[model samples]
Target: MTACGLPRSGPTRGQIYSGSVEKGGSTHVVNVDDRVNRAANYSPAYGFGSDFQSAGQVGADEVRPGDVLGLSIWENVDDGLLTSMGASSTQLQQLQVDSQGYIFVPYAGKIMAAGNSPDELRRLITEKLSTQTPDPQVMVTRVAGDGATVSVLGKVHAQGVYPIERPTRKLSSMLSRAGGVSIEPEIAVITVKRGGNSGKVWLRDLYSNSRNDIALRPGDIILVEEDQRSFTALGALGGQTKVPLGNEQVNAIEAVAMVGGLQTSLADPKGVFVMREEPQSVARAVLGRNDIYGTQRMAYVLDLTKPDGMFLARDFVIRDSDTVYVTEAPMVQWTKTLNVILAPVNQIRTTEQGF
Candidate 1:
């Protein structure tokens, strides 16, 4: 017997043989066939995946002003040898290298600091200081300064400029410092703009296993996107629900589960429907053989009758601003009606009898 106490039956033959009255159990066989047909046609169409790659790449060489300049200098001194060094300290005092990539020092005057390591800066400074003090000491330090400010905008707790001090800064670390992404995962798209350029960085790539490196530069803007679309889910399963599709996408079965899954007494379990708007732009793109953003304007119908359907649930990712709906069993309404009709009559009889 099945869990619901229905008899477990083996697979039957074809329609004519199984449903014919001469073969016996014609109504049962016919119903089974109808159910299969419904399940086959009920799968939803829309899903999710990588949509675009125009976002700018995060490379290591993007440096800005107010960035610390660490320096060390060594020179031949009359009293043995003297070495002096200074690490960039304050946002204001951080060495400001000019457009020509030269930093001005007290004694060295103007020396190139860009594209040079601490040891290199020390050597350069030593060369300049040596001209005055016979054997001058040298030091280099990239101090903490205003040059390393990174801007984080969009769906973060505190969207503004963040200072970069370490050798490497990660996307996740930056987001955490900026108060993290919003609670709504789907509506958020983190855009990292390099050098004030309009291009963005893909959040997925930063989170994924491949090439998870985002070297930040000064003036990079991270924009968090808000939820842009709205969708509704209703039907046989649990209660109807409405959800907004921000930057992320959702799928059919997942949508059903989100609204509390099928109400055992009211849900059919096998019937589900996803209704969505049909936009002309999407159709035009599809017809013109253009790559349309897959997450936009699509719906799906799913049947969760069989065990294997569970696997499909994962592959069918949903989009931001999509809807899911489940319909109730046909007999549920009749059962409710019968209960309502009997309630008044039972109440009247009890009142008259004072029971």
Candidate 2:
């Protein structure tokens, strides 16, 4: 009888399908102990609140074309040669840096002001006017300018190119200036591109971490992407769905719950598994094997029947692009046989007892 049947509560005999095993690649069997030890320690490049910092920043605010300057020149020494009737302060010159990068001045001809800061331009202008008047005072203010600009794209309210005229514009400030993120905080990934380098980070982290919210540099490209980090739940569950892990820094237990846990009666609790594709380096470190599984692609399993499995699930952090699979119990044969053998016997025994 024992050889002919197996209990419904226990996991049925497992088989490795031909398609499941490849000649060179095979899934390493993972159990509760492995999940608690190895899977719990698993970390990916973009997982576990990963910090991807900018390679470099735009050092300082630079003067560029299309910048408008408010120039106020003071010829304090009104020698009457330059001053026309008590003229001490020259009229404000709203000069816009032209395509040739030159701004015209009354006594100082066309002066190159594109590369120099307001202070530097002021000194340059004052020096040029020194021959004409003594102790010349010059003030250059960037009243209006697109000297520094950042390209903001993707899912944000005000998505466009914004000017960064002020010094030290932080990432959070820029995002706010661009009308904040479009959707929920959990579902957004902020990608920053600076010069030849680029990296991505969770918007949640950008909002929380001061280090990650670095200053925006001139020519920095910021993009707010929809959170793509998610785990797909398959097999005997309430529904087969992909649950988005908004900056997913959650554990296995939470992930399972979000995916609707299991289809209580249909799912075999002991057959719960997390399928991960680990990188070559991670796989090699986790498993002693240097095989293709070293590519951070590996399978991790958990048996809820175990007394400590539930506790271990809490520590097991699920990463991006992982698959949570729940295998169903093999109940059809057991149900049929139980009815066929026990039904008639129970009926006869009840009659014999005169119940």
Candidate 3:
């Protein structure tokens, strides 16, 4: 009985297939081919979506509540309303915008500064003070504050609130102002949250895909995260462990090679298998059926012994949380059986020699 069957690294290809369609099991074991490869090819969607991408850039000159402003009023005559004894101009510095978005000018009364640009506010202030003072020249300068700022956190060199300025009016420029990402760009993921909406994209895509570099907005929250896409490699391989996908796309061939390739002396070239939970849509496409309504258990078989086996493996895409298993060669089980039977016989011979 021991010689008939022995312990192996994993189940044989035949055993796996036999149990696939069992009464209690719903696993679909399908041989991978060109058609299946095409149906199963997957690329994760990573973008900021249409609304975020189409948003215009933030107005850097626009003022908001909680900002500080500087105003200077100049009069043609030295003894004007805002001027000192001999000075033709007077300065009002550090005028903070109230919560209601109003700023008080000495002679100009309360003015709304939140929605207006500095130039517009300057013109408005000059017009208001013209009645009291003759041809008053006004200058409005905006100072950075918390009203129009964004918080950047996670995996960035600097985690803090950044103000929207001319140089940092867009998402990419703001990230740069924060000292860029500390993690690898290829695996870094950037997420932006504004109000009730949020979007995510790969860091590399910001430059490669122009649409991903969206404009920044006030009160936006930006986060940089490490990519979590990875798969588990087990059975007749050099090592059994969870491997991170370092690139945007990883195929079966690359995944196998990632874990130090298969154990040359023990791996069965015909029993390489990729196991995953397939979504209903992908399942229907792969099986050429429409009855599957939910996520299904799927086991894709790859026969490396065939002429096109390597090509099929190369074309087969590996998704996150997938399991890549390679069974041991058939001779390995026979070798284990022979060792079990020969152990007792060798022990008996040793006892006879001792007597």
Candidate 4:
């Protein structure tokens, strides 16, 4: 009954090994060893390069178009050009900078406000109004507006547009202004998009490495997201599902333990396999060949019964999208067959004794 293909979980060791060379099969079955463990230890790099780290904090309060400014002008004479109704002072509130970076005043005509500081614009306005009024006093101040602001979104407590203030000019500070990330710091990723350039770094890296805390720019968009790395667990195991990587790095032993270690009653200790696609460089190093191109399919076998198997599994890394499978023991099927054949016999014997 067992030879007639009795029910079992996943393929057996023989099937997996033989399938590697069979027609239409591309998988290469290899045993987990120290050499294979070193070759397959591949991890994708994540960080903000020099392009993002080189920028220093810039002047956050620099005026720009779309900014709102308030101008207060005072003259010694009660009937001065800017004064009104015999008053010696005049207030112009809600003075918005036009698209061309210019703002108009009553006697000052049009003054370029975008590229100048508040003090610079104030001096320029005072000089212009002096021609019509005696020693005109002018004050310019920046108000809340859309200029020099950044948009923060994704996995944060607050998602909105924030102005680039003096204290919130750096990436980390801006994230704090948005109430920080809601996800786990270990798995959270911060992405900054400026113009046509974009960069990403782990939330922990932002503080661990000072260079990652780059300066924030106007019109920049920031997004915080959780890590998406995960592996699939299949066959004779406590839980067969896609398991999210809980840590930054995970090994084969840890991966199996996460899914509730192999089912001792029905699992074959020698048939454990970790299946994944290996890059050309890694495949060449593992197989000692130069014919490899693109990615190649690989099924690494782990025999817990061997003396060095446990160590090999401990050193072997489980990468994203990899599959960990454990086949059922050979005797499990025979036991099921016997149970199916003798169930009726046992029932009939019980009925005879009752009669």
lDDT string, candidate 2, 241-303, tens digits: 888877557787887788677887778777777887766666565565566433544566777
lDDT (0 to 1) per candidate: 0.52, 0.72, 0.89, 0.87
Ranking by lDDT: 3, 4, 2, 1
Better of 2 and 4 by lDDT: 4
Among all windows of 10 consecutive residues in model 3, the one with the lowest summed lDDT is 17-26
Which pairs of residues collide in model 3?
none
Model 1, backbone clash pairs (residues 3+ apart or across chains), number: 56
Query: What digit string (tens of lDDT, one per residue) describes model 3 on residues 1-355?
Result: 8955665667877778887855355799989999999998886677887889788987888889999999988998868987889898988999999999999998789999998999999999999998998888999887557789999999999999999989998889999999999998989999999999999988888888888889998899999999888999989998899999865688999999998998999999999999999899999999999888899999999999899999999999899899999988888887888899999999999999999
Q: What is the lDDT of residue 216 in candidate 2?
A: 70
Question: Using Cα atoms with residue i matched to residue i, what is each candidate's TM-score against the true structure?
Answer: 0.46, 0.69, 0.82, 0.80
Please give the range of 10 consecutive residues that has the lowest summed lDDT in model 2.
10-19
Name the regions of candidate 1 deviating beyond 4 angstroms. 1-64, 67-95, 105-109, 128-133, 152-160, 175-191, 195-210, 222-230, 234-241, 244-250, 260-317, 323-355
lDDT of 4 at 183: 90
Which structure is stronger by TM-score: 3 or 4?
Answer: 3
Candidate order by decreasing TM-score: 3, 4, 2, 1
Query: Which segments of model 2 are wrong by more than 4 Å?
Result: 1-13, 17-25, 32-36, 43-62, 65-115, 128-144, 291-296, 333-355
Model 4: per-residue Cα lDDT over 1-355, one tens digit each: 4446666777877778878934457898888788888888877767776877787665876788899999888898877886777787888999999889999997678889987889989989988888887888888888756778999999999999998889999999999999999998988988899888899888988899888899987889999999888999998887899999844789989999999998989888899899998888999998878988889999999999999999999888889999999988878777888887888999999999999
State the displacement of the C-alpha of residue 110, model 3, in Å, after optimal TM-score superposition: 6.5
Q: Per-residue lDDT for 44 in model 3?
A: 67
